[model samples]
Target: EAGVAQSPRYKIIEKRQSVAFWCNPISGHATLYWYQQILGQGPKLLIQFQNNGVVDDSQLPKDRFSAERLKGVDSTLKIQPAKLEDSAVYLCASSLDPHPDRNTEAFFGQGTRLTVV
Candidate 1:
């Protein structure tokens, strides 16, 4: 009955510092996703995971951003040497299936707002 969970609702750091965010998806969900949303822009898919294996990560910035879904349950996203452009909301979502045509709707957690100074 519980929804997805995310930690550290807000974070602020200097441009060169590193930050990490955590997420725990709902039970029975098989598809988990991480998104980035800058102000005034729609969320952009950064990565997608089907269970513990990565399904997509083409949009993720390998230079500084990384994510992982451990044990097909909890997930973590990290940004090292953060840039000013990294200031945005990091959203975690999950669905019962991976196909976009499926009827299942993704449930989102309270996003982590990152501010890079």
Candidate 2:
């Protein structure tokens, strides 16, 4: 009955610093996702995981961003040498199923807003 959970609702860092965010998906959900949202832009999928296995991460910036789903439950996203462009909200979402064609809707957590000075 509970929804996804995220930590550190807000963060501020200077450019080139490192930041990390945490997420805990809803119970019974097998599909978890991490997204980045810049102001005025829609959420961009950074990575996706199905039961601890990576399903997709094509859009993730491998040079500076990384993510992992541990034991098919909790997840973490990190950005090293953060740039000013990385100032955005980091969102976590989870769906009950992994199949995209399924009608299940994803539940989102309160995003962590990162500000790079």
Candidate 3:
């Protein structure tokens, strides 16, 4: 199965600088998600979108992190004034529906590793 695509496999930025990551979800997938996985920790959901409408963004740090899915397709995540604690592998995932069932399952991208120096 073809996986979702993410750009900039790795990124390193000084603390307080800004960084952005891009994602291209699998075709026909209607639900998209973004997650942050800090070192030694499991991936944590940051935001999710059903089509172009935001379904959840409770975990996203609105003050520093922002994400948007344009036209219900490609997505971008940006963090400004990044902190050292923000270093992580950002993962993008998508599914045919919001809830997984026998027919549809979520697919994840390879992720973009971000390092805050």
Q: Give one digit per residue, the lDDT tens place, for model 2 in 1-117.
A: 888999999999999999999999999999999999999999999999989999999999999999988899999999998999999999999999967678678899999999999
Candidate 2 or 3, higher lDDT?
Answer: 2
Root-mean-square deviation (CA) per prediction: 1.1, 1.0, 1.4
- TM-score for each prediction? 0.96, 0.96, 0.94
Local distance difference test, each candidate: 0.94, 0.95, 0.93
Clash-forming residue pairs, model 3: none
How would you order the candidates by lDDT, starting with the best?
Answer: 2, 1, 3
Give the local distance difference test score of model 3.
0.93
Alpha-carbon runs more than 4 Å astray in model 3: 99-104
Query: Which 10 consecutive positions of candidate 2 have the poorest summed lDDT?
Result: 97-106
lDDT of 2 at 45: 95
Model 1 lDDT tens row, 57-95 = 999999999898889999999999899999999999999
Lowest lDDT sum, 10 consecutive residues, model 3, at 97-106
Error of 1 at 29 (Å): 0.5
RMSD of 2: 1.0
lDDT of 1: 0.94
